[model samples]
Target: MTGLTHHFLKMNGLGNDFVVLDLRREPLALTDALARAIADRDKGIGCDQLITIEEPRHGGDAFMGIRNQDGGTVEACGNAARCIGRLILDETGKDAVVIETLGGDTVATRADDGNITVDMGAPRLRWDEIPLSEEFQDTRGIELEIGPLGNPIMHSPGVVNVGNPHAVFFVDDADAIDLERSGPMLEHHPLFPERANISVAEVLSPTHLKLRTWERGAGLTRACGTAACAATVAAIRRRKTERRITVSLPGGDLTVEWLPDSENGPGHVLMTGPVMLDYEGDLDPALLSGAAA
Candidate 1:
């Protein structure tokens, strides 16, 4: 080991785990092979993602950059932002933090509800932006289907990209279908060139929703922050809700609110959720002792 010197922190938001590397000082880059080697559970310190902190582009807070275990780069990760914010707070003793992502800016606030609230910026809902293979007139409900459940009439989905691409299918039952089996097919589906996170959502009422997600590169995550935001916006656009809602996932719940911007402000989404301080440790060389450079 070169003793390249990496300061690592372990954190999770509602069981969505992460391994954070503080790189704001001297930005470091990970190659595809290096990322895969680092994400290996047996040969390396296991993690759903490898996060790096960088200097912020906007005027305030810090930036959180993310790479999946599979070595894929994505715009934003909601849970990771919360964990990163907590780490920044612990170090700085600040109540708020502004996190930067490839997608945009997200401002985080520690709420009395024992969780963090992040203003996740506005969602992108254009056919070309979502980058579906074909241009569609309507994105609220795109005509992409899956297995027995994805046979058009049985499975019509709403496609939206909240930094990362997502296809949310409104279902009557969250457990009635198998997401693990179908997530891969839809994520790598021909439509999404950048691939996408597949989400199954059930709107219980005007302000309550339930969901299960198959994240691109990450597999079936207990909870996904952007998935919740996508579902809420899709539901609202579909006339299923007003503007705000509580989305329940296997991991936990996150409150999503879409607020109108001021005359000079841009519209944005607010996602409030919790982040946990998991045990932290360094990556013992022994863990990746067998990894080839």
Candidate 2:
């Protein structure tokens, strides 16, 4: 593939950055090594996740394949959906777009303020849906804790799955804890068979929260759209907040709303945020071969 150049776009939602490859026109086989090489901060394009846009398989506008910086594939990415949604909307001059993802189908639409709003679908709270290592009668607060059993530093995280599994721990102050030290451990905890996105959320009011996330496969991220969705749902389940709330992350603030489960609605989690197009460029094919610049 040397001497060939692949066009790519660098984009970010809030501050969770990504390298997007629109392979709809021409499909390109992506390998783990190539993904890692492309995500290398110093030697490569550098991003939190690598996104591949493909033709939709389920009657949607497009399909998005997400790979973490470590080159591991995962299901669902909220920010990426909004970014891709905007692309599709602009291309088609439409107000809404449905994006198919491994996790599920998400609906993205243009907001009144020009920001993108993605309907992340309903939260999966069943113990089996979350696929915990053990069965629990109630998933609102699982029986998992960090530190010593007698005096644990963190415990009883409210777990939910918004396309992917997540464990949200409500704290008095999100900045008080050292997430860099705690995120990896919690993400890999035995309670979660598929691992989890770890988050610490501090509720400032019934409608406001401060959050930080240790994303699985990716380390600490400035912003995680799913994490915000999970935290908002978790807080609502615990009666800590209302159905609608604003979650502030290290990168910025996002609006998360859990619709009421009514006869007419199934209660989907809606996430609204901003995405920016940083730049566009082509990848030197030699980079895939680890060649010198």
**Local distance difference test, each candidate:** 0.81, 0.90
Tens digits of per-residue lDDT for model 2 on 17-131? 9999999875677888888889889989999999999999989999999999889999989988889989988987878889999999999999868799999999999989987
> Candidate 2 local accuracy as lDDT?
0.90
List candidate 1 stretches off by more than 4 Å. Answer: 2-5, 25-29, 58-60, 93-95, 148-154, 286-292
- Per-residue lDDT of model 1, residues 1-293, tens digit only: 44454457777887778888777765455576666777777776667888888877777678788889897888989888878877777677877777889977777888766788888888888999987999999999987776555354236689887888889998888888788788889899899999999999888999999999999998988888888998888888898987888999998889999886679775788989998877767655533333435
TM-score of each: 0.91, 0.97
At residue 16, candidate 2 shows an lDDT of 96
